[model samples]
Target: MRAVHHLRGAAAAAALTLLAVSGCAEKDGGGGSGAIQVTASDSACKVSRTEFPAGHVKLAVENKGSKVTEVYIYAPGDRIVTERENIGPGTKADITAEVKAGSYEIACKPGMKGDGIRQKVTATGQGSAKPQDPRLDRSVAEYRKYVQAQADETLPKAEKFAAAVKAGDIEGAKKTYAVSRVGWERTEPVAESFGDIDPKVDVREDGLEQGQTWTGWHRLEKALWTDKKIGAAEKKLADQLITDLKDWQKRVGTAEINATSMANGAKELLDEVATGKVTGEEERYSHTDLVDFHANVEGAHKSYELLRPVAAERDPALAAELDKQFKALFTLLDKYREKGSPDGFAAYDTVGKDDRKELSDAVNALAEPLSKLAAAVAS
Candidate 1:
């Protein structure tokens, strides 16, 4: 609670600094209408042009792979400009996105996954700034509010969870741990925007190096569930996680949000579920992977909802179809919910391979529709 109050006070104090620059970013969005042709296969990622002036860049992606494929345009910092996914063999689709002047990679994922074959493209000159798309601007505003709300929800839960551990109430901490993860999982993409905070707050035990600061959720999880004790050092780390959460919210609130980011983040959250939760690898100690999975879905759904109107305007049927897919995915997930609440869900080890497969299939089902979102809504 103190953390939340402090965040509100800090936010109010910095209102002028944050809100003054809050509206549409003066970013050099790709507003150009010219289409760049790309061809994808098992061995290659080929593009019609190596570079174009930064503004609105359109791509016509043709997947020649025997298996399903995906293509992405990545900026220098591994930021996703845009991507098109689940293109069947011999299928073609258009991907459009706004890019600033920078070096980028056009990557083709041939077998539907892997570090893809990449070709470099450079945008040399600043193309003229066209007016920001009002729909995208509205989506960005809504996303910011969503992130802020998630952040606000995060601090209090985190504080209580941390306090439980520090007080050596192991059972109480176990109960609170799943409850606290909702905001953290939902806003993970937003939290990861700041370079250092995400690692500090969420990095797994396997990720830690020799003699580095052992903090964040997983470290505490290991202590509570594995070691079955929280000593002075672990207690200190618990307190630090709360303080970091407070600082984390302040930094993320001021960062920019746009269509590509929102769409990419939604996809990334699904990927997070696939890579960690579905694999039963994330909550290795507690086996509470379903909690994170549900939270990620909630976050991704929010991101999609932010773009719903624009997607509806672009193609009404596509929008409606996506809505149906989302509903179906939630229905499938609901069966896994413990006591029919989002906060409680089936333990990871309790789910057999068959159960995991069904969840995976549902996720993949929703992912195909979601993969189209960024490209569809791109200006």
Candidate 2:
């Protein structure tokens, strides 16, 4: 049951003031094809080049590990410049990110846990900060506003869920549980940027670090559904959940967001769905995986749509492919909806193997094209 998704989280960092969208192209300095080669094995992380010119950089990553792995480009203070997750064994990806002149680490998290193996590198020379396109500016602003709105809507729903738990109403808490999570799931990339908040509010039991207390939504979820009772401890945790989420609500305004991050974040949502929801690891007890699945798709689609104008302008073919894949995935997901269900989707546990396979296939289809989004917008 300890899938690759159980261990994903990010720390907080200041907003990157530099404006540059990502697109794969020829290397700025003297390098072949302009992509830094990254090889991630079980024991080591290797980068072909130690440094590159600031502006747009590409890391062509290959996972040689036996287990799934994720790669992150962290600025000096662990601020994520850009990252690619759920790179399964023997797979490869070309990740494009915007970087300024500074030191950074290319980290490989094999098995998707812990501090990750790091490779130090520097962004030499000046960064490309001039506005590439006015459309991208609009894209960033609109995405930020959308993230804020999701946060604004989440607080009230989470409060209601907390209240229901405190009042010792199992059925009431269950009803509100998936509803409260929709907003958070939709904008997890933003929410996860705050280092201390994500684990506090959303960490799964298996994802917990040693000595870390399990106190988020999943903890309470187990109590409500599996344990089937809310005692004093559960009530206290309910209050703690609200406090932690409110911290996330307050910090949403400060998250590091950019055109590249938005594009990367959209891809991250698909990773979340593939690793966690599609596998039935998330929302395990309540079987609300589909609810989370829907939200993840919605969030990813929001990012894609906002960046569509620019993406389409840069690469029309990729844009059309993305539209088709997104529609196909959404259409498949729509088949699972149920009017009688609390979350408007059939229980995940009841989903047949054939159906789950179909869902996973559709997600993979969308993710493959979606992965190229950063490079498309970069142009």
Q: CA lDDT, every prediction?
A: 0.70, 0.79
* Residues 84-157, model 1: lDDT tens digits: 55667887766555656777788898875666899999876776676767988988888888888888898999
Q: Say which candidate scores most in TM-score.
A: 2
Candidate 2's residue-wise lDDT over 1-379, tens digit each? 1222323344445535232232222344312466788899999999999988897776788889998998877666665555666778987766656677878788999997778999999889997675668788888889888988888899999999999999999999999999999988888645545656777788888878679889889999999999999999999999998898778777767777777777866776786688789989998999999999998899889999999998898899999999999999999999999998877999999999999999999998998788789767876
Best by lDDT: 2
The TM-score, computed over Cα atoms with residue i paired to residue i, of candidate 1 is 0.75
Candidate 2 accuracy as TM-score: 0.88
